[model samples]
Target: MPLALYLLAVAVFAMGTSEFMLAGLLPDIAAALDVSLGTAGLLTSAFAAGMVVGAPLMAALSRRWPARTCLLGFVLLFAGAHVVGALTASFAVLLITRITAALANAGFLAVALTVAATLVPTDRKGRAVAVLLSGTTVAMIAGVPAGAALGVLLGWRAPFWAIALLCLPAAVGVTKVVPNPAGDGPGQGRRPSLRSEFAQLTNPGLVLTMLVGALVNGASFATITYVAPVVISTAGMGELWVPIVLLLFGFGSFIGVAVAGRLSDRHPEAVIGVGGPLLLLGWVAMASVATEPAALVLSVFVQGALSFGVGSTLIARVLYQAAGAPTMGGSYATAALNIGAAGGPAIAAASLGAHAGALGPVWASSLLTAVAMVIALPSLRVIAPGAGEATR
Candidate 1:
């Protein structure tokens, strides 16, 4: 991978840390801001909403700008938002900062996906993307915990300041490394018009590709959203084991993504076809053995590996299918993943509200993954017989 890809991943790490770290600081934020915990949780919802809406909106608005310029602006904007968030005393101001930060994060991710793909050869696009996305998995493993510790030591607002500081190096790196899309690169030449970009939305292959991505991601999140409950209540584990279980899941995900990156370019459809069924089975296993502590822990790791392995493959497929519309392709990919991230927890919460036990999230994951497979398997046969490379 290029140094530019690593620099992009550095930026992603800072943003991902800010995105997930808030979960640990919500209680502190609520107390400090004189708001209810439920109200403070709205900050998270606002960020998710911003990502879903901002991915495409920001991408389109910045479509004509140079890739380097867009990335630099987004990174600096993200840092500035965090700085403001750290200094704000009003809950409303802090909430707005989260939304602004999320918008910047979404735009950065969208453009980064396109830039990463273009930075590599057609065959290595999946690996390039995997390298880029590895930042998030790393964040889950390291950054979130560090942020939580920072919050505990220096107070909740401290992590926000740290995140803003982290972005400074990322901004400097982006400005120095990222190439202009219009320069002598794979993304060079005539840009697609807005009309042509919209036309790709009607591509059946691209639509199915994104749908599969969303459903798979939704299934992953449904289980992950309630992982603590499943580990504690369902499996009767001690509270101390929660972090251990989560760490296992994160480590597994990192391994899965790395492995999938190597295979995705060569066996994209075959990997997804096999991994999807296994992922559904993994969820079912979790639901069935919810009370078995050993089985439950193992299941979490296996499911994480399978979920990200398949999920990353599907996203690579989306990029390939929507390759003609470079600007909109990443937007569609970012929006689909964020949609899943938002919807999965809502469905899981509903399942719990209906008197389902701790296993409800596992069941929800199973159903969603099964649906993804049903849609994806047949579609792959029709659209991806030899579809490793971009189609148009």
Candidate 2:
């Protein structure tokens, strides 16, 4: 609840807007660049690839720098990339811009999480993280829709211009408000070596927690990526109502994170153990009620809440397990989440291809989330010795 934490959330809001807004702009981009929709879609893939590669690389590179410096540098780089992207018409140039932006995005998030974790006591870390991550839900609720409207009313490039402008204030906020934590100065305890950082992965609890993060995100995206089509074809909603459905999901996400933040502090195990099974049930409900408008709306809300609730706990779990390498731990979590976001859609698409229904993705999501919960349940023993007592 430090002002710096809110500033970090503002920074994250800009990054999340840029990342999610692209989905709504792809068609305009494809037409403008004279590329196929499939080719333009590669922009998203390129960004995800950059995130996977950049998180650890950038975190390692900036290990010796002050956390404030690293954050300021990444935010500036991110803003600059958006400016270039806004000016570009060529598909290849735009792709490069997205990749560059994503690298900076990854760096910003890893450092932000590290900073947030350090800003509070051990018990409050989960709430602090939730405050930072609420930016994503806010972006989904407001930014994406606004960007889509801007694209339709003005042009595809308009969203990029707005994103670039948004980043400037966030950059300034970080520069002006975020404190440089004491002892994070250059030449702080021997810089984290790549070997030691990678060694953290050897801890089975940390690795499993990271995997759970991936699976949680993957499951959510599997259904989310195709939600618009499902709403239209299955629920009989008009195309114009798609945004409303997404807004409901976003609202649920916001509430979920708010609840998870407090609950994670009091009962981390319940966040996973109880929330995970509910997420699976939510997906199953979605599949069962795909054609029922009222039922589907409720299902969407439940799915969103449970997905993010479980996700926030997975994040806190990884942070706990990877206490030895906090920065690297955050990077690993970011990488795992992006990997799931990228992979879940692909898997769902394949299932749809084979089964031919809106429910296909829902079923796929159910299976993935169920497996994630199973992986998470046993790992509670490894990550928290008091989890049993806490849950009871």
Instruction: Please name the candidate that would achieve the greatest lDDT relative to the true structure.
Output: 1
RMSD of each: 1.7, 2.2
What's the residue-level lDDT of 305 in candidate 2? 84
lDDT of 1 by residue, 19-134 (tens): 87888899999999999999999999999999999998988898877888889999999999999999999999999999999999999999999888888887777798789888
Lowest summed lDDT window (length 10), candidate 2: 383-392
Model 1: lDDT of residue 378: 82
lDDT of each: 0.86, 0.83
List the candidates' TM-scores in order.
0.97, 0.96
- Off-target runs (Cα >4 Å) in candidate 2 are 184-192, 384-392
Give every collision pair in model 2. Answer: none
Return the TM-score for candidate 2, rounded to 2 decimals: 0.96
